[model samples]
Target: MKKKLLLVLSILLNSYLLSAQIFTVNNIQYNVISTNEVEIITYLGSDTNIEIPNTAESNNITYQVVKIKNGAFYQKGLTSASIPSSIVTIESGAFSSNQLTSVFISNGVLTIGSDAFSNNSLTSISLPNSITFIGDSAFANNVITNIDIPDNVISLGKYAFVSNLLETVVLGANLENIGESAFNNNSISEIVIPNKVTTIKKNAFSSNSIENITIGSGVTNIEEGAFLYNPVVNVTSLSTTPANLPLSAFDNNFNISLTIPENTSEVYANAGWVDFGSVNGETLELETFIIDEIEYSIINLGLRHVEIENYYGSSIDLVLPSEVVHEGSTYKITEIGDLVFKNKNLSSVILPNNLTRIGYDSFSHNNLLTITIPDNVYTIDSYAFKDNQLISVNLSSKVNYIGNEAFSENVLTNVLIPNDVKIIGNAAFYDNSIRTLTIGSSVQKIGSYAFHSNKITNVTIPDNVITISNLAFYGNKIKNLIIGNGLKTIGVSAFNNNLLRTVIIPENVKSIEYFAFDNNPVSEVFCKSSKPFLYNDLFANKNNIDLTIPADSYYAYNDSYWIGFKSITDGTDLIDTTINQIPGLLLISNHGTISNNLQEYVSLKIYNTKGQQVLNNNLNGIYIVVANDSLGNMVVKKMYVQ
Candidate 1:
């Protein structure tokens, strides 16, 4: 009995020494113990056949087996590896550098670390459905011919399962993400990405010799150069209606044919793979239009194609066909499209009298110094002559309507807006160098920004005008504004930043748009009628000036915003009463004002030498004294003190 007990104690002591010794199994750290002749360490170095111990006691210690790590028998000398169901986590770097003919991971293993079983000589690997995460570099550079990732794995890390001799990679339905370069440089003839994968990183299967690719429907933004320079035979994105397939996403590939889905609307410019290629052996169509006996085509977005005939004159300076007459009338042939002659260096163009509407962007961006619009043309399209370096334009009075942005950014010094024009769109003359603008008496409406950002010093808005669009005269250097007697509404931001000294609001005008004259340097607004001129914070800064209102309208003006004003009945009396009445009026022009005391009524009329009333007003107060004989020119008048 004493000998047996001593022998048991000796065995225990030997197990302790063996367990304390650390050994590196294929570069993996492990502590083994040997007891009672039981092997504590197992070196499965590139072995093909690996069997988990069943009741194999080591060091007399009962070990709890948890997992059979990946590469546990990678490239091992053994021919087969049958993993037991007791494994849970296949730690990274485990089972590597082993020569294994076959690897069978049991279903009980839940996690597989990276690089496990990589560079293996195994003919096949059927991962069980128990794997949740295939770690980085797992099974990379392997000899696996085909792989179907189990539905249980959720993610695959970078280089995991890459560089394998895989002919087909069937990602499982449970896959959520494919790591970068996971399947790069692999012989994947075809791959059907799982719909569960939300992202496929860069170079993931980039250099793979894939003849077919099936992208899942879950992907939205295909990362830049994701599949660039690949030898993909047939790449089909699952998205039937690709929202934003970039221009260079799949460019530079060796694909035989591509079929754009039915729901796609726009195809990018360079998306056709090469610089110029026939779409199904047919050239892409573009918008084409004709003008002046010449066919113009706008190809590929902005390139203009023009084909000319030889029947026209080739004088080099002026080109006009010999037979300009087409119909019985003097009008010649006519056809014009948008931007027909835009950006051209043509020296001159002669339009026949039969010509009508000028097309949109017809003469835009041209360097022509002078242009003559024929009297037969009644319409001018938008941007017809915009941004042109023209010095003068002979606009025929026959032009009835002008479209939006017709003549913006031009160099015209003076402009005569025809009375036939009914509508003028926004920015029609914006940023132009026009000095004087004369609105014809027949004009009705003025569109937004008609004369904005121009160098106009004087403007005479016709009384028949109804609506003045926003910012009509904004950023102009105009010092004088003649508001017509029938003007009604003033649009927002109009007359902002002007250097006007005084402005007379006609009685017929109703609404004054917000910020119309907010920042104008005008000192006073002259009211010729009894009506009150509405004011808000827009006129808060100009509250100190004295507002001259008619005697009857003084109460209305005072109640609104005119805190300071001179109440007068007759227009002539104010000029004769004292010189103080003409405060800001003379600041612009020193023209002496005239008064008529004989006119007892509120109306005062000043006639010129032709006996015609050149100026008519009703306000009567201490007016600037001046003598007006037969002519309306100012004559010397006796000055009066207060």
Candidate 2:
């Protein structure tokens, strides 16, 4: 009838171009998408353990590979990837620059596009609740450490999981927005942020190592440098209308301890959000009142103070009441709010001599062996008494700030940092079995990894320490370090891996960075700087140490970092012949033999004027020898050991 309808429309346009053709079977490359589906498109397989198949026969017609197209396995040297509930959409730069450490992602993954799995070495990731949209830079620069974002994740695009060694993120409660620089530069120490997120974009969580942020009352547009360079000490914000941020969001952390919603703290202290620090609101109309059955709360009904907040009596040896009259109103408890006795298997509680604040994470993960920190506490906020089973604490000689990880992972065999502690935050007493640490002459900054991994054997940095930050006393068994004439910066790896053999660098030490005495076996340094002390690879064993400069300073230690010191001497006639032979060099004997002609005496402690430690040749009454010299020079004589 018209040439049989033009030959049946030319056989239905050649069966729709042979079902959108582009084929290849085992080494993957698919694209058919019709006669029974198929999408993958690239990966001419050199197999670094890939397994992404789910059906692909090609010309014999099998298909059903679903979608994975754009730049399919871009730069694939993928170490391990299984991804196959017929992968629903994984497009842009598919497995970007891979050396992927491990990825399973199977439940019909719905969308994970731009730079998908970017530059990988992924430590751990399993996001497939049929993932809803996670595009830009998908798992960027990954050594992923942890991630959970999949509760049907709704959009997370820009730089999605940027630079990841992310220590735990759980976002995605139908996440909504949160894009630019997505979880930027991770090591995210605690972040909650999920209540249908609502825009947190720019530099999303910038340079994180975020120490506790919680923010989610449907967030509401946080954006600029999102949580810039975080070290955010305890935030909380369930948004009782405080969102509009931008004082550069949270860079320069402003000493945080926020927590809101309840009387809203004067609308979050008039919206600058209390300019960052102590907010603490959360009162559901206050009036709690419970005494020995614990609860408390009243918060300042005109100075009748009160605040234990919650503990329904099951005493693992508890005892609190500094004042709790209640209906007839006496109150005066003073505060111990956040997570009141957390995980309270409290093996000794007793703290309320009108406790003046001990809030966030009050007695964290407890089984407290002994605490006693009540001198009207003056704030001991972050993880106050952290992960306890603490073998004796008693700190708070009116504690003037001792927050981040306050007494972290403890076994504390003695840690007295209380001369009204001025700032000893980050990892404050971290991983401790601290064998006698006492650093408090009003400690002025000793934060990062402060007393990290301790079993301290002499580290006297207290002359009002002016910053000894990064890795402060790193992995210590510090055999005498003593750098504090108000030390001015000695940060990166400060006293790293120590068993330090004599290092007294203090004439207001201006910057000693890098691996500050890295893995120390440092044999004698004693630099009381007459200037030139801006070091870097500080001293693993700079050609076997022995530095000692401060005479005419030997033209500031003849350069090249004290000429890689294995002898730079000139210590002003060895410090005026060791301070004029320390007034009769302690020669005691008569069987209590103490003798010290002082040839750089390393450690001789006799002690007994009731400071109890006698045995330097079995010393008796009024002793106190205390020698210590490989030039950190301290010869405290006073002997009468007869």
**Evaluated with TM-score, which candidate comes out highest?**
1
Whole-model alpha-carbon lDDT for candidate 1 = 0.59
Error of 2 at 331 (Å): 7.6
Which regions in candidate 1 have their CA more than 4 angstroms from the true location?
1-293, 296-331, 345-347, 538-540, 564-642
User: In angstroms, how far off is 464's CA in candidate 1?
Assistant: 1.3
Tens digit of per-residue lDDT, candidate 2, span 1-642: 999998888888876786668877767778776778878878885556788878888557777788888878887555678878976888888887655678888898788888877765566888878888888888876557778888788888888787555788888788878889888756688788887787888878875668788888877778777876565778887978767776567743235677777787777656656334356733235466666677776644656776777888777887777887867767777777778788878888778787876877878987888888788776677787888878887776877667789779978888888787666778977997887877778665677887788788886777766556688778878787666675556778877887887877765454567887789897877776554543677776777776777654443344325665665566544423324233224455577667654332345777777787766675556677777644455667677766
Q: What CA root-mean-square deviation does each model show from the true structure?
A: 35.0, 24.9
**Displacement of the residue 99 alpha carbon in candidate 2, Å:** 4.2
Model 1: per-residue lDDT, tens digit, 338-393? 56677675556675455555666876876666778887666676798888776777
On the 0 to 100 scale, the lDDT of residue 608 in model 2 is 78
- On a 0 to 1 TM-score scale, where does candidate 2 land against the true structure? 0.35
**Candidate 2 residue 176 C-alpha distance from true site, Å:** 5.0
- TM per candidate comes to 0.40, 0.35
